[model samples]
Target: MDNASLKKRDLAVLWHPCSQMKDYERYPMTPIKRGEGVYLEDFDGNRYIDAVSSWWVNLFGHSNPIIANAMKEQVDKLEHVIFAGFTHEPAIDLAEQLVAMTPEGLDRVFYGENGSSAVEIALKMSLHYWQLAGKPEKTQFIALESGYHGETTGALAVSDLGLYKAPYKPLMFDVMTAPSPDCFYREEGESWHDYSLRQFEKMRELVEREHKKVAAIIVEPLVQCASGMRMYHPVYLSELRKLCDEFDVHLIADEIAVGFGRTGTLFACEQADISPDFMCVSKGLTAGFLPLSAMLTRESIFQAFYDDYEKLTAFLHSHSYTGYATGCAVAKATLDIFQSQPVIENNKVLAQHMAQATAHFADHPNIAEVRQTGMILAAEMVQDKKSRTPYNWKERRGMRVYEHALSQGALLRPLGNIVYFMPPYVITPEEIDKLADIAWQGIQLATKD
Candidate 1:
C-alpha cells in the first residue's frame, strides 16, 4: 500500500496511546520500518535519530543483537505460561540478577508488563504490607508535584501534572502532594545543596505531620522526566531518607525512567547513599528489548505478606503477562550486556560533554534553563528567561520544535516547553554532538515566533 493508504488505514484501525485521536488527521503517523542503534528508519526509507530512545525505553539502543537473540531463543522454548503456578529459568535468573544489580535491600522482585503496572504493584504492596502489619489506617500516599509515574488509575492519582489527571479527578485517590526540588529557576545564587534542603524540608514536614496515615512517600529520584525534565541534587535524597526513617514511612523510589545507569549510576538511589523500601524499575530493565517492569522491595516488606494464607493478607497482585518468558530472557541477556560492555562508563563521558555544550543555551534570552543529570539533558524555553516564565501551552511551541526536528532528520520531541534528550546508552561522543546540534537548531527554528 502507498503512504496515503497506510495513513488512512492507521486512522481507521489503530488507536495510539496517550493521544487525542483527532490530531491524527493533522499529523499522520510515520510508520517506522526498522531500528538500529540510536536510529529509526521509516517505511519511506527516511532515517531519524531516535533522540528520546522511543519514549525513554531504548537504553542499549533499538534492535540490539544480544537482546534480540535472547528473545528469539526464549520464544522458541516457552512463549508464556501461567505465572501464578509455573515459573521459568529466565524468570528466576532475571530476578536474581535484578536483586543483585538493584539498590541495597531490594532483595525481592514482583514482575509486571509495563512501568505503570510495576508502580501499581509497588503501591499495592506498600498498602498491603501496612495493612497486614495491623496498621490498615496507613493507606495514604504522598507524591511530589509535577511527578509523572504512569497512566493507570493508581499511578495517575500520584502524578501531579493536572493536564493528564485533571479530568479524572473523580477517579483519583487521595494523595498528599509536595513541591518538587526545582533547582534550575530557584532564587538567585541558591546552591544545589541548599535548594535540595529546602525541597527536602517540605517533604519532611509533610511526612512528619501525615506519617500516621501515610503508607509511603514516592519520588522520582534525581530527575523527574515527565514534568519538564526537572532535576534535583542527590543530597535531597539523603535527607529525605532520614525523615522517612524518623516518621516510619516507606520511601518508594520510582526509578522506572531513570534506572539502569541513566544517572551515571546503576540505580539513581546509589548517588544519594540511600536505599528505598521499594523501587519501581522498568524502562531500561530489559535494555528496551521487551516489555518488562519490576517492583523490588526489602525482606521486611516481604515478611509482612508472609502470613497464613487464610488471612488473605498476602500481597496478592498479579498481571496476566507477569514474568513473561521472553521478556525475562531478554532482560537477563540485557544485564549481561551491561557487565561485558562499558555502557555506563561510556555514558559518563557523553554526559559530561552534553552538560558542557548545553551550557551555551543557558543564557539565551528565549532559553529558561538547562538541566543535566547523568546523560539525560533538557533545555527549557521561556518567553521571559530572566523571569523564568515559560510560553503558554496553547502556543504548542514545544510540539512545533518536535515536528521541526523530525523534518530535520532528528527525533527530538519536546516535553511541553522543554526540549530534552534521553538517547540510548550506545550513542557515541560524535553522535552526542549531532544530537546537540540538531537540538540547538530546533531551538532556533522553534523560537521564530
Candidate 2:
C-alpha cells in the first residue's frame, strides 16, 4: 500500500531495465501511485515533478484525458484483431494521419510495438529492398559514432555505443563507423555550423568509399539523445541527405526521441528540408498512453515487395500486437491534439524559458557546457572545466545529482555526467523555473568533491 512496502515486494521478484539490480539495495525504488499533469505522486502523497517525461515518452502529460478517452472508447469496441488479414478503423485512420503528417514522400507506414522494434523493421526493410533489387552485396550499414538506436540484435548491430554493445559483440554484425557531427568537440571559437560542416567531410569520405557495399546510413538527426544530448547544426543533415542521394543509399532518420515538437519543429528533418528514405517514430506517437510505433517510408520502397507470394519477395515481418486498436486510437488522439492546438508556438515560449533558466550554467566552474534543442536542455558536469575533461564513469557523479533531485521532489535522471531536462508539453513556465532550480542545486552538490 505504501512506497516502502511496494518497493520491497518489487525488489524480491522484479528486475528493472537499464539498471544494476544490486544498486536497488542502496537506493530503493519509489513506487508511484498515480500521475497527472507533469507530476507523479507516490502512495505517501509525496509528489515529484516529471522532469524527464517518464523516459521522454509522455508528450502532453501523464494520464492525459483526451488520449485516455480515446483508448477507452476503442477498447470497448474492438481491443485488437489480427493485423495480417483483418483491419480496423483506428489502425487505418492513424496510418493515414501519420502518412500525411510526416515528410512529403513517406507514403507508407509499418506498425511496430516500440522504438527498438521500429529500428529493426527499418534495418531489415532496407536490406531486403536492396537484395530484391539484385544488390545482395550491399549489406553493410554506416552509423555515427556514439549513436544509440535500440538493443535488439539487428538494431544493436547498427548502433555504435560501447556501453550497450560491448557485451553483445558476438551477437552483433559488423557495422561501419562514421565520425559524429557533435558540436561538443568543436574547436575554440568555431561555430556549430562550421564545425558540423567540417565533421561532415569525414562522413562524406566514408560514404564515398563504402557506398558500393553500404545499404544505408542511419543517423539520429539533430540530437543524439542517449549520447549525453550531444547536438549539431542542421547543415549536417542537409549534407548527409545530398551524399546519400548521390550514392544511391537509403537514409534512416531515427526520430524516436526528437519527434513531436521536441526539437523546435514537428520533426527534426524538416529543419534540413529533406525527406529520408525511412523515418522511425515512436515514444510520443501514443503520448505515453500506450505502446506503439510507426516506420514511414516512400512508395517506391513499398513497391519493391509487391510481387506474388510464390516469389518469396514479400516482407514477412510482424508483431503479435501489430496495429493494435487501442494503441492506434490513442495515437490518433495524440495527433489530433497536435493539430487542434498551438503546441509548436507554445513550445517555442517554453523552450525560451528553459534556455533562460539554464543559461547561468555556462559560467559554472565545473560545468563544461549547457546545451539545448527546443524543450530539451542539458548540463554536462566536468572534473576540469578548462580542459573539458569528463569525470570517470566509475565516479558516478551523475548519480549524486539524481539522488539530490529525488530528495527535492523532482525527477532529474542523468545520462552519466550529463543532467538533462525533457518535461512534458503540459508543463508550465513556472514549473520549468522550479525544475531548473532543483537541477542547479543538485549539480552544485554533485560537483562538490
Candidate 3:
C-alpha cells in the first residue's frame, strides 16, 4: 500500500501514544514498511536513517542477524512457558549472566515485561521491603525535579515531568521532589561540578529531614533522557550515594534508557563507583528484539521477604511474560555481543566524532546549548542565547526540525525545543556525518522566522 493509504487506514483505527490526534491533520504519521541496519524504509521505497534508535532501544541495528537468529532458534524449541511454576533454560542462563555482569552486590533479579513495569516493581519492592522490616511508615518516594521514569501508576507518581504527569495529578500519589542537578542551567562562570554540589545540598537537606518516611531516592544517574536529556556531573551521583548510605535509605537507579552502552560506560553508575539498591534495566536488554525488563537488587533486599508462605513474607509480583524464553534468548545475545566485541571502546570513537560534528551548532544564533553524553547529542533551541531563554513550547520549534529531517530522509525526533541524536551502535561514521548535517540544516529551518 502507498503511504497515504496506509496512513489513512491507521488514522481511522489507531490512536498513537504521546501525541494529540487532531495534530495528525497537519503532521501525519510515516508508515514504515521495513528496517535494516540503521535505516527504515517506507512502502513507497523512501528511506530514513533510524535515529533515536527507535525510541532508544535498537542497539546493534535494525533486524540484527545475531539477535534475530537467536530468537528464531528459541521459538523452535520453546516460545514461552508459565514462569510462575515452570522454569526455562534461557531465563536461567540470562539471569546468571546479568548477575555476573552488572555491578557488584546486585545478585538477584526480578523480571517485568516493560520499562514502566520494571519501575513499578522497584517502587513496590522498596516499599514492601521497608514495610516488612518494621518501618511501615517509610512509604514515600523522592524523585528529582524534571525527572521522567515511566508512565505506570506508581512510576508516574514519582515522575516530575509536567508534560506527562500534570494532567493526571489528581490520580497519582503524592511524591517529594528534589531539585535536579542538571548542569544546563549552570551560571555563566560556574563549573558543572560546583553547580552540581550546590544542587546536592537541597537533596541532602530533604533526606536528612525525611529519611524516616522516604522509602527510596530514585535517580537516572548521569543523564536524564526523557527530560530532554538533561545531564549532570558524576560527582552528584557519588555524593547522593553517600547521602543515601548515611540516611539509611535505598537508592534506586533507573537505567532503562541509558544502560547497555548508551552512555560512555557499560552502566552510568560505574562512573560514580556506586551500586544502587535497585537497578532497573530494559530497552536495550533484548537489543529491541523483544519486550523485557529486569529489576536487579542486592541480596540484602532480596532476603527481606525470605520466610515461609505461612508467615506471608513472600514478595508477590509476577507478569504473564516474566522471564520469557525468546526475550531472554535475545537478551543473552545482546550481552554476548557486548562481551565478545569492544562496543564501549568503539562508542568512544563515535562519540568523539559526534561531538566534533555538532560543534558548529555552538555558533548558531538560536542554539542555547550543544551538549552530549556518549552516543547521545542534543541541541537546545532558544529565544535568547545570552540568557538561555527557551523558545515558547506552543511555537512547536522542535516539530519544524522533525518535519525538515523527515523531508531530508532522516528521523530526528525532538523533545520540546531540543533536537537530539541517539543512533544505534552499528551506525557508521559516515552515517553520523549525515545525521549531523541533516540536524544542522533542520535546526536552521526550525529556528528561522
Each model's lDDT = 0.87, 0.93, 0.93
Model 2, 148-205: lDDT tens digits are: 8988998888888888889999998899999999999999999999999999999999
Per-model TM against the reference: 0.97, 0.99, 0.99
Clashes of 1: 0
Q: What is the lDDT of residue 281 in candidate 2?
A: 97
Which portions of model 1 miss their true places by more than 4 Å?
Answer: none
**Where is model 3 more than 4 Å wrong at Cα?**
none
Model 1 TM-score is 0.97
Is candidate 1 or 3 superior in TM-score?
Answer: 3
Residue 407 in model 1: lDDT: 85
Clashing pairs in model 1? none
Tens-digit lDDT string for candidate 1 (1-449): 45666787788888898788997766667888889999898877788889898988888878898889998999999999989979899999999999998877889989999999988999988888887788999999999988989999999999999989999999989899998997884778898889989878888888878899999999999998988889999999999899889888899999999998888998899999899998998988888777899889999888877878897866678888998888999889989988898878888998998887677888778997787889899999888877878788788788777887888788887888899988888887787787787788878877887
Assess the local accuracy of residue 305 in candidate 2 as a C-alpha lDDT between 0 and 100: 93
